[model samples]
Target: MTDGKVKARLKWACRRGMLELDVLFIPFVNEAYDDLSEQDKLTFERLLTCQDPELFAWFMGHEACEDTELNAMVQFILGRVKV
Candidate 1:
């Protein structure tokens, strides 16, 4: 329920999705993301946990700030993404 917690979760979630997300889209999404309410971020984070369909939903702009689990599997992905 805290923004800091959500941000931490989201940072992890972001790395997990690895997503093949467009680097170009980062600034745009980050800006829009900054303007979003925290609840929106949590929701989007949830949606992020799924496979391509849910990921595509965010990419396609159908979902914003969906809630997705940021677990050990995600952390593993985050580790790979870090390098």
Candidate 2:
């Protein structure tokens, strides 16, 4: 897929019922997605596949993601935003 198409899809995927998530994800995709290594981009996509509640907990530091890779990705995202 083209970069534009991939970004479009990622933007759509970033939309969540929770405003907090939307704020984090939408901007990350817009500003940072293109800069990601291909593997990290894939990891981001994998992060998206997680359930919202799980994502919320992880992002909010209520719980840690059990999968080390996913947890690292979560920390990466949070670090980007300094959250």
Candidate 3:
């Protein structure tokens, strides 16, 4: 797929059933995804595969991922929304 198609797909994946996840993901994909390294892009894609409850736990500070790549991606998303 072309880069544009990949981005379109990622954008679709960003639209979670949960409003809170939507708020965090959609803007990040639009604004920050282009700036991510190839590996970080993969990491974010991996993160998108995780369950909503696990994502909520990590993003909300209830828990941290043992996988460093996943943790970093979680932090990357969280960093964008912190005041």
Best by lDDT: 2
Clashing pairs in 3: none
Please, what is the whole-model Cα lDDT of each candidate in the order they appear? Answer: 0.48, 0.92, 0.91
Task: Please state the error at residue 2 of candidate 2 in Å.
Answer: 0.7
lDDT of 3 at 1: 90
Each prediction's RMSD to truth: 10.8, 1.1, 0.9
lDDT of 3 at 62: 94
Report the candidate with higher lDDT, 1 versus 3. Answer: 3
Q: List the candidate 1 regions with Cα displacement exceeding 4 Å.
A: 17-19, 22-29, 52-83
Better of 2 and 3 by TM-score: 2
User: lDDT tens digits, residues 24-79, model 3?
Assistant: 99999999999999999999999999999998888889999999999988887887
Clash counts per candidate, in order, are: 13, 0, 0
Clashes of 2: 0
TM per prediction: 0.42, 0.95, 0.95
Count steric clashes of candidate 1: 13
